[model samples]
Target: MTLSNSRFLFSAAGLALASLLPEQAAIAQSAAPATITVQVNKPGGAIPKNMYGLFFEDINFAADGGLYPELVKNKSFETDDHLIGWKAVKGAAGLESYIVSSDRPISATNNHFLRLSAKAGGADAGFVNEGFRGMGVKQNAEYTFSVYARRGPGSVSGMTVTLEETRRPGPGPETPPSGQALAQAQITGLTNEWKKYTVVLKPSATAARARLKLTLDGAGTADIDVVSLFPKDTWMNRENGLRPDIVQLLKDMKPGFLRFPGGCIVEGITLDNRYQWKETIGDVAARKPIINRWNKEFKHRYTPDYYQSFGLGFFEYFQLSEDIGAEPLPILNVGMACQFNSAELAPISAAKGPNAAGQGDEPTLETFIQDALDLIEFANGPATSTWGAKRVAMGHPAPFNLKMIGIGNEQWGPQYLERYEPFSKAVKAKYPNIQLVSSVGPSPDGDLFDKATFKMRELKAEFIDEHYYAKPEWFRQNASRYDKYPRSGPKIFAGEYAAQSVAIASPDNKNSWDCAISEAAFMTGLERNSDVVGMASYAPMLAHVDAWQWTPNMIWFDNLNVYGTVNYYVQLLFSQNKGTSMLPVQLPGNAKNGADNLFTSAVTDAPTGDVIVKLVNYSTTPRAVKVNLAGAKKVGKTGRALVMACDDLSVQNSIQEPKKLAPKEGQFAVSGSTVNYTLAPNSFTVLRIPAKK
Candidate 1:
């Protein structure tokens, strides 16, 4: 039978069966022992190297507060609201402060600096910066503090910087700072010329709600910009680096590709505010900051202070990809704004040429296309090239060796095609080796998706990016959505997807076991069709517990702690166990649509000579599956099974109970060629069995 017809029959039969007896239906389904036949020697196709990875967007304070690790917000005071994160000390008498904008600024992009003035004997005058939901400091951990300062006026001896713990009384308002100081630093040198001074302070105690205070000592005015504090033990110990704990979670996943700088951030709220790569390179201070596209995305979770520091810019992204041993996949705007937001279009004239009828000083389609070309040069061009020279000046003389570029993110319709066509052609004509990725809108099924896919196929695009945020049942039902995809069309990049427990972008959505298990069932289909589906990743990778704008992120973190949700463990299992080649697994009398609540996929590790079988049981009752390993000379008796199971489907992991739904490992014995394993209900399992030589 055809796949669709089979799916229909399965659904029909399931519905019919459900009408009989609800309680006995599950029992009846589990009564028969399912038989799975695995052909270990017959491999179908080689899996893509970048089969599973991460999609990082700047949403949910992932960059500024969660990962980038810069304790101070509004460091350069460049925002329209310059003093959003800073507040003057209440009791500091005769002290005044304001932001000073300069024509001859520190950098062309960063033009604002904080200026403080204090009268004689006004020693206590200074400002206090409340970090992103309060800084996270560990006991005895050394934190490096730095500031760009210059002597302004009356005799100023130096500045005293202190890290103090602040208390919150009940839930009303935050109380005054306690007398205890976590760390302190003294900067004595005051010169007329601007200079950067650094000091290290080891905190005597740990505090999750720590605040940074800067006070003037001898009464004078001092100009300060780029006030920053970072834990010395960052990822790789690099100055101005990412949080080690957060990076460690990503490192443990063994991701294949790292898609950086964002989902919607690529296509900003407006064309003028799109993510410009050139502005994100060079010096950290020079890298201009902009309001995050997600700043006020959701009305309920509106965060006006959210902005992109660009501290974790393209350079940092490339370096991080290299450090994590994953391919760097950067998505750029195709001269089109986010359709959901502004839907602004760039001026383009096919008959009149590249710059014809340009929109009065506004960037034309050619400019956007040129940005793509310049980005390629910046990433892979020789040192003599203009953009390449800038890359070298940023410290890395070697090219980042970018292999692929995504044209847009979840974009659709004729306008998207009009933009994508020229961008892809230009990129391919210049750099034929670099592959291009196209998008099929946000939803998996729609008229826009069909239109985009048809156009992409006509253009012979290399890859087509697809996104889906659906209900848990939708994921389980659509597991075979790609089975009917044409084998000769553009490959697939299941870029941004997550199973929403409640609804898309709803605050009520959760990273629950039901959603994770449904995703596992869907991922099995992705793995089975690895030839067509080259890459896939979960959306909104990280979220801050206190300041998140999105729900059901893979990883959730607070000030001092982070925990991976059940979905994280599901992705981790598939990613870490991604074998080299796909092996065929046959199930007789079992619905391919997983109507029996059993989904399975098999793969063989060519180098290790092991057969890995992934199985997900979605029923309420346990299932006993008899697996027959055919075409194998000898099978190892002892094998390992990793199972992620929970007693309740709605149970979720939190900061306090991180490992509540983590995987449990156990040894299973395989008798001859027939292995009988009992699969836990509502659980995902992976069995790695070796082949004896």
Candidate 2:
């Protein structure tokens, strides 16, 4: 039997055991039945439609290997080492290869390409590229392979490209295609001028671990750049697209908003490396590549080759948000660098001469403010405008209709506010309708957080972004964190949050049931105080199994498969079942405010007129509760229950056992005005009941 069914069946035994002990029997009988009185007639407040969404950061290889879906890692040979992801093929010692830099490159931003020189009769001389955790190929699936090549010096023949499985063989009755080629294609034409060559290959067999090989047939020198391989079936079938599986997962969640290109990346280690939105748009070839700030943030999990190709840039983010039916929330740098890093400041002038106001200074705070204004123009300005014309040239003639923009990502202190004040004012002055989201720095408990909150409150900021990565216990205790906040102050956006199984950034952290359940408990409070909280989302959305820098992410994936964590299901449950209006739910004395580890919140869907109640039981023993639909005209006899329960808190979902902690659906009966249900211990349950007219 499934975990939910077993828990439902064992409730009788639990009661029988209680009857065996006099003290327990008395306590159970005198517990006032743990009544949950739901006032269905009156709606307290309207919940934000974009309440539960996603916060996507480029950390943990989330972009390159996880979501962007480009099979080749170093596609442009722009890494510091140039040949980071490429290697010399075996038996190809006759060929010499090095990086060739040019003053005039394919684009001014990208200036490196592989130069391979081969001697006569060196047919095996070529290069092999190890894709991100090896390319995943399926039987009869079509993949597009392309390369930018130019013949140089000696005469050369065409190049041959092949996809082959490189995994070691294991013990099995059926022979494995370990060393067999799944797909092969040849490019015959190579002129003296640089040109892009394209070919399509259909893999004859499926392989979970594969590599791409490029072999030059004749003797000569060839220059190769921007080698790329992609499956034909991308999301929306768009060229240079995202992984369908990952995008599908986000689409399935029905996310209300997508906060993109973020986290510490918005504020780079220094001012020079900050994520400049202008550089990420326009021609993909001209878009400059930068080393990912997360490349070496943690010495223990250093990834030297991690870089941002900006293939998935601002325009793509907006398009993705549109495709997924989510609101696009793009955050820009606010003149200050990452506080944890260099903390460089943009030039500020107070002089009184020709050099006054830093007019001649190449880069100053004024220029930074212009970037923000240009971004707004790029997103929502008319197509005739300069920045908007660029957007039109990029195939999006219509505006993204961006209603909100974030000024900074986790920046705080006087320096942050000093920079943020001017940027926020300028953005609001030019685009008064745009809602600006301000930051509260890294933690929720530090003096920096307090100072930032005070400043935003003084400024009457519209929305304040708070972030936290704490233990499960902290989440459970902070369920009422926003309960006491003044309703007149700035609204709250739980922008970046996830319960860490271990301490923050620990490599041992896992997306365990303990963390998920605690987050569920806390989310009830977020739902309870919907008026003050405008939005919330789980952070570090995607992580690669082999190239991860952080743990406890919402989704985990390898080359061939992807699965949502138990935490993901928790967010999914809340997001998918978000109701239109909040309804008051009260518990009996002592059991109120989750004193007994039982948390509950109620909401009513205006369209369906269905009452949705979410309950989280953090105790170790089952609790039988009476749900009284007080003030309801009529309660349906049948209702639906979705339960996510597990036997142990430490048990986690993995690639092999992806559904170990998934939700189970069941039916329940509700009589006239009351429904008695036994909530499984350490579980999250959602009940949806139709209200008769």
Candidate 3:
């Protein structure tokens, strides 16, 4: 009998047998074991070097409180409400008042400064700063406290800085500062000219919810701007650096590239608030701050105090990519706001060119094109060049070697196409070598997305970005979504995608095992179609446990610690095991993908001379399969299997139990050219056998 007819007959016989027997006494017969054949000799296509990468956006306090290690929230007092993180000393009747002053500021851009008028000098006459969900400080760790301060007409000779743990009260409007001090330092030299003061404070005890207090020594007035408290041990131990633990986690992943500066932040709530890369560079204190696009975007998790300090800006992003050994891929604004927001677009016309547009005037399509050109120059230009000089002044004399740039972020329809036409042409006219990635609609499938894809093909775009956030079942079923894609058109960038356990953007969604396994099942398709799908990454890369607005992030952290989610491990495994070339795999009945709840894909690592086979078994029962490495010259007797399996789909990782759902490695014996292995229930497995053709 044919394969389909034999399966049908087997099911019919099983149903008949079940009908004849008692419900509780019935016993089922085992079906035939499955087989996967890998054509090792026929390596089809070369996998893109930058295949599996990362997508970073400034949502969920991913930058300010999560990655950027600056302890102070509004360091320069630059938020709309200048006193968001500052509170007056509760029992300080001696202190007069404090106000945000802009008189004779540090710079034209950073206009706000905290001016304190003290009636008397004592421990009580000061202000308290509640850090990002309270600072996470370690015992015997040194923290650098720096602030820009200048004395006004007063007798205040110095300032006292103290780090103390916060105390909670029982049912009343209460004070926040705990009198017990963990660390203390003093700033003795107060000058009329604005000068930066620095001192190191080593905490005597570890505190998870510590607050910083600044008290004056003498009765007087003082101005403070750019108040900062950063950990001494940062990533690479550089000044104004990232959190070491978080950076180490990213570096360990070996991501192929880093696409940065944002998702919706590229197109702001309005044209005015869009992330301007120019403003994000230069001195960290001088980089102007703006309200985060996600501050009030979601009403359920409303963060009215959310804002972007731009401390972690384009320069820092490029530096981070270099440190992690990943290519830098920067996405820029295309003179269009978010479609879901205002749907604003800049005027497009032939008259709008380099000579017509002024720096201070309203933006045109040419302004965006010019920005792209200048960005390329800034990233890869000689030190003698204009924008490149800015790079040299920032201390990086060498080029960032940027290769790819995304034009827009999750945009679609005729407006995008019209704007993209001239923008692409202008960029290519100047920097033809730089590849451009065009954007499509938010959802993966629809009339608008399809039409945009068609238009992008006609435009001969280098890459088309497609975003999708859907149920876990959608990911499992769409494992072969790109199997039939045309090979001659633009390559695919699965830019921002995650399998939502609940629903897209739902506050209740979780980074559960089910969602991670579903993503693995779909990533098999990404690997199988490496010829057309050049790049892919998970969305909203990081989230803070206390200050997050979005769910299902790849990595989650709090003030002091971070943990990779179940989805993070899946991405990590795929990125670490991505092979050099595609090795075609054949399953039972020549199924393309996801047959019988089993998903499989194979690739060969050139350097290691090993065959890497990735498999996802979604069934609840263990599955026995024979992996036949066909046309192999020599196969090692021993092999390795890295597996992550969980019985509960809803189980997740927390700060306390980070590695509860991590991968485990074990050895398996390979007999001749076939390896017989049983996949555990609901597991994602990667098998590596040392073999060569």
TM-score of 2: 0.92
lDDT, candidate 1, at 567:
95
lDDT by residue for model 2 over 220-268, one digit each (tens)?
7888888988889889898978999999999989999999889889888
Go through the candidates in order and give the clash count of each. Answer: 0, 0, 0
Cα RMSD (angstroms) for every candidate in the order listed: 6.5, 4.6, 6.5
User: What is candidate 3's lDDT per residue for 376-434, written digit by digit as tens?
Assistant: 99999999999999999999999999888999889899999999999999999988899
**For candidate 3, which ten residues in a row score worst on lDDT?**
1-10
Model 1 steric clash total: 0
Q: lDDT scores for all predictions?
A: 0.83, 0.82, 0.86
Per-residue CA lDDT of model 1 for 91-120, tens digit only, reads 436465555667355766778888887774
Q: What is the lDDT of candidate 2?
A: 0.82
Model 2: residues >4 Å from true position, as ranges? 1-32, 90-93, 121-123, 168-178, 350-362
Q: What ranges in model 3 sit over 4 Å off? A: 1-31, 90-93, 169-175, 350-360
